[model samples]
Target: MHESLPISVFIIARDEADRIARAIDSVSDFADEVIVVDSGSRDDTIAVAESRGATVFRNDWAGYGPQKRFAEDACRNDWLFNLDADEAATPELVAEIRKLFAAGPPGTASFWQVRIKDVFAHESGPAPWAYGYNQIRLYDRRVGRFSESPVHDTVRPPAGARLGQLSAPMAHRSIRSIAFHVEKMNRYSTMQADDMASRGRRLARHRLLTEFPLAFLKAYLVRRYALYGWWGLVISTNFAYTRFLRLAKTYERELAARARSDSGAA
Candidate 1:
């Protein structure tokens, strides 16, 4: 039976006390092993996870890519399900996952991309694409691992690997309030800027003014974000703005460096 296949659920978190238990509980039904890799959390996240029978490991803060990879490598099973502290696995998803392991997925199959249901405060709607939500969360661990990006890390499967989507959805509570969104935007924007800087790339003015606006329009209007109403508007606008801010910060740094170089010649 697919249920007999060794499956491990791995989570990487920090200061996620408020939400970690929900994540653990959601997967407890099907997960053969639940491993939590925490990056020096000061809160009760560790205790909560331990109480839920999760094997908690403490490591210093690493970038998202490295942190996730570390947790993946630690899993005892060859099949890994990577989840965030704020995300929960729906029963439908759990059943589908169990079925896949029973029949044994193809050798060429590397990952399953799960659909996400985004819930706003007291409201539920489809997530805008700009929210960067569609993600590959389940995979055969032997084929490949996640890339080592400081932010927005992606799983890279081996060559000729096939990707598929699951019918069940992963419930995501992304925007608890406007304040929650703001805080996340601020944190992620800084991480993105740092990532670009490390890569020796700067955002060009043309790209920012031309490309970003079009991207926003495609997400908010063309994607019919209006259907989600005001909350959708907030999601779209903030999503676009955060991207702009990340690139703009990178550009601003370049300008400062150029000015310093010119001043030195004078």
Candidate 2:
């Protein structure tokens, strides 16, 4: 018989004192265990988590995946729910999770896809709330760990692990300001460049013209970012530009290094 699981809610944060409280409040009702792993935050983030009765642990700054993986591993429960400090669990979702646990532990359900209510800076149309943007938030800790991608870290559920969906929606309130976007791009782009370099990919120049434009069109126009009007357009454009900048900057650095090597060899 599968043993009943103790559901632990974990969040990895850095300099998120302003938003961490909201995230914690959202899940406070349903979560049996709330764990917050902070990565060298310069703000009162640690204090906020501690105030909420959450188990707070402070560590040096690491990449997203590694930080989350560390937090997950620190959890003392069998079942884990990974939440960002900017994301909140809706009351409806909380109730659903409670019911799920009440019916004994989830044995076959190793992973679950929960809907994400992606709130934008300006609510233009319907707020993009629907049956899409699902993420594997709740999962069995034993299934698989989070990928150590410095940029976009993700949990890789184990093979043959049953995946389910929850009716409740997880509200994402992080991607609001332009400042956040810029800083995130700077950090993630650098990480991505390092990732590509590790793979030994050759430098390519044409990527500048090709990748940037396409990224802008795909994210802004094709993805209906126009629906949100100017702000959305700006956000989408920046999103695309960030990706381009990552590749372009990395390629340029590699090329310069190669030329220096060639000159030295001659």
Flag regions of model 2 displaced more than 4 Å: 1-5, 122-126, 129-132
Which residue pairs show collisions in model 2?
Answer: none
Model 2: per-residue Cα lDDT over 122-193, one tens digit each: 542136522237788998877777888765667788777778999778888757588887888887788788
Please, what is the TM-score per model? 0.88, 0.89
Candidate 1: give the clashing pairs: 2-101, 2-102
How many residue pairs clash in each candidate at the backbone level? 2, 0
Cα misplacement distance, residue 251 of candidate 2 (Å)? 1.1
| Among all candidates shown, the one with the greatest TM-score | 2
Query: What lDDT score belongs to each candidate, Candidate 1 first?
Result: 0.80, 0.80
Error at 128, model 1, angstroms:
12
Best by lDDT: 1
Which 10 consecutive residues of model 2 have the lowest summed lDDT?
A: 123-132
